[model samples]
Target: MDGSLKEEQILMSSERDWTDLPPNLIHLISQKLPDLRYFIRCGAVCKRWFSSILLSDPPPQQLPWLIEYDEQFPRASPLKEELPFYSFVTGETGSIPIQESHRGKVYHRTGHSYLLVIDGEVISLFNPLTNEEISLPQLPSRFDFIWPVFGGADPSRNWPWHISLVCDVGRSRYLTYYLDRMRWQCFDTVLHKTCNWDGMLFTTEDHGTSTLVFDAASRKELYTIPPLNEETFGFITSYFVESCGELLRVSLDYNLTRNIETYIFLIYKLNFEGGKGQPHWVKVSNIRDQIIFLDHLTGFAVRATAGLKGNCIYFFIEEHCRSDRFYNDSTLWRYDIATGTCEPVPCPFNRCSWFVPNLR
Candidate 1:
């Protein structure tokens, strides 16, 4: 019972193996993890911990990470193949290496952890998290722009993939590709700023004046919601994001006068209580516990967790050239729906997409 005995006991406890912890205890610990980053780290402790963590439910939705990439990288040589990712939860930067086979390709777009890339006659969807690559057949060279819409299942599940591509070249057209079919079928429709909600695609046409609902699987036009009669004094751009099992339209209104630019945001939710045929738009002052992430092409909603703010919209601002002078640098900004205020969020990357990290 002297000093030597006490020291010996402490040393033994310190050397104990963490893998010996019971699976149930490990599951309990994983449930208390604040974010997916910590959950993933906990799993890396040992094989037993990884197995247990996989059995337990994943941690709550974490803040989306900003994925940074250079679109203008020289394609003549295979250089700068790694893409950097910045996490708001941890305030740290991490990167993943792009495969050499996928190098020298044009990065078309990104959504939900997947990158759409074009290489000559091949179009591929690459997920940096899982290192999974899906190659689609090349489309006619006439269409220039492509936007992916994940349908049928959540973005977290990558299997049984159902993707709809919005191909645009002055006129817009829709195309659907299913894993089962392994082919892309074109749907001639003029849809803009589309979002998927509950297996349906909601889109706006005619400059946000009308909302069109389409059955994603059937490729049939269901109905349309009459436009909101609100008036504003500036140029307006609309985006659709699904929130809390409902469709919400976010309008970004901006005006440039005398070399000064100002922005205003307006939110409206699609109300269906009146009836599906008579659905109406209702102005929403608050988003409750949700946060919206938007880039230039698409936007999505995620529930707020600890260390995150709800009722806010985080979006990217691109650099613009005014009067032969570069005025602003590309950056990220947060707009608070409750306060009706906008502020810049610190980001080191210029061109980025919102990516929610997941193991699957």
Candidate 2:
């Protein structure tokens, strides 16, 4: 082969136009992009790619991303720069720049695909990718924490949100206000957790030992978690995940260490298939092909696909996972549900939660 021919081949490859690809093929390429930043970059390549990205607003099988807290990594300025988000599929990191007035706001809580952020006295549901926010129902000016329940947000019409607000004042009532409802509904219950599967609020008279579902929309008790004898499991934290239309209670009894490598997890499934309110805790040894990701506070389950590992629980280790000791919580891990083993998942960012980016 001639040297000139080889040189021309290199130049031809370098100058190839990606826009020449078919629109249907471009659309297929856009469908697999998990990060909004990737879509933006692909769209910037050419007009055809831009139109392709715009048309693929809600991608098929949107995987959750791990968005690190702005403070978790070194930045020019926490308020000046964008927050980095890592995608599990692409193995790439993208930044979500703080737009307009949301620069100073602090992150409060993470929902399915949204975040509850507090901007002084006003609390808002913020979607970082699209820069869309909806003001939540006003509190009594002295609220402790608010959990945003993710429902119809983006690529769809605005639907009601079942948001839980825990007030730490005079009466100390656990209240939840539905966006569809006009008034805030108060519950006498203490421990509060929102079941992300069906937007059902799980609360109990006891402090997290037993769980019950409280529906603020109708002001009714939908179901009750039978008294789980804490004396038996003796777990410091009872992490609950609703998967496949079943309520699962994962009991972890471990003394966490920086050097330690494994953990013992007792998995329990609520036997409510027979009927509602008649469920009992059944010990399950196998988690099969389902993958669980614990996004800081709540655990999210997804079917293992692509090259992703399954039969494992991806847990965010808040404190020791970061490179800097000063940074409080910023680490991710994959816990094998079968072997009760865990390993740190290497990523460039931290303080991760389940995030589905929506441009629509």
Candidate 3:
């Protein structure tokens, strides 16, 4: 009792305010906080707390946004029931239905915050940040005979807002949607008429449907490449082609049994622009089987299978006959275009596909 009383009396003689604490100590508290919303609110208590906690980077343990799906291809399960997004961030898998009245599935695009959806007969672009959505009225049924391909460019780059949907209703009719002013422009490609336009729409090797592109500045038709690998219609797939980065193509190989195998692969680089610019596709990897692809950026040929949404390119590091185990533990590789390198990525599922948006 005497010792405790003496220590307390001595400490009371030399005291410090909360502001006297080091910035590191304040930062550690913010990291230990359970939620960002609460941590930010606590910082409002005083300037010392505000500046340190709100302005500085959180500790490593504070980054709670990383969501890892370790089971590559475990089984067939609905995302709503199996891997709900609500439980993903909160660690409590629950449903948070969006009340917005819209049809069609909302998917996470390459840009994490943005969503791309086809709402009913109309196409829509949404940004959850602004809590705003832009929907286009259905195109005239006259042009409904043809399918529409939609996409957006990085807004900061001044890329023209593009909507290209071809209609063979009359002569070859081309319609484009421009967002800068929110309008649609139409052009016709009749053999006798001049084809004055801005961008071109075409398909690529494994892409099931066509791709539409518009020039960023001029808002003019660029070029259209068709997805020629698949013979079926309405089977659209996405591709990513970068001028400086390696080009990767992911597709599927299906035989008469309807059993499929996934592939991840890239093509060899072939310069075709006379060394002035990027190369052009000279030959496909599997021309005979019509399973080869030529990436427009690198002009390399790759033979592989398609993924769920062009998220992965699946191919075996070592070839095996059908008699062998189909899904063996052999090393499977996924090529990252951003890194310009192809490395082995472990896959744990029997038959799974990765969903990646905006490859092209």
Which candidate wins on TM-score? 1
Writing each residue's lDDT as its tens digit, candidate 1 over 16-99 gives 677999999998888777667788889999889988988987765556788775655421112247878888767778886777
Query: Model 3, range 1-360, lDDT digits (tens) per residue?
Result: 699999999998888687766788887776665434346566787888888875666432221111122243122121222222221113432222343453233332212222334444555454432435656555544333333333322221233444444344554443433333455555433211111122332233333333333353355655453433444322223343322222323333333222223222333222337647533443234222112212111111222222111322333332221224443453444443333344444543323222211111
Candidate 3, run of 10 with poorest lDDT: 289-298
TM-score of each model, in listed order: 0.79, 0.76, 0.38
Please list all clashing residue pairs in model 1, or write none if there are none: none
Off by over 4 Å in 2: 1-16, 34-37, 70-80, 88-91, 149-158, 166-182, 196-200, 204-208, 218-224, 229-234, 256-260, 286-288, 318-330, 348-352
Q: What order do candidates take by TM-score, descending?
A: 1, 2, 3
lDDT value, residue 154 of candidate 2:
27
Residue 7 Cα positional deviation in candidate 1, in Å, after optimal superposition: 9.8
Q: Residue by residue across 171-262, what tens digits does model 2's lDDT show?
A: 54455444446455665444544443354566543223666765545657777766665443222455667666566776554444333354
Give the TM-score (vs. native) of candidate 3: 0.38
User: Could you tell me the lDDT of residue 286 within candidate 1?
Assistant: 92
Name the top lDDT candidate.
Answer: 1
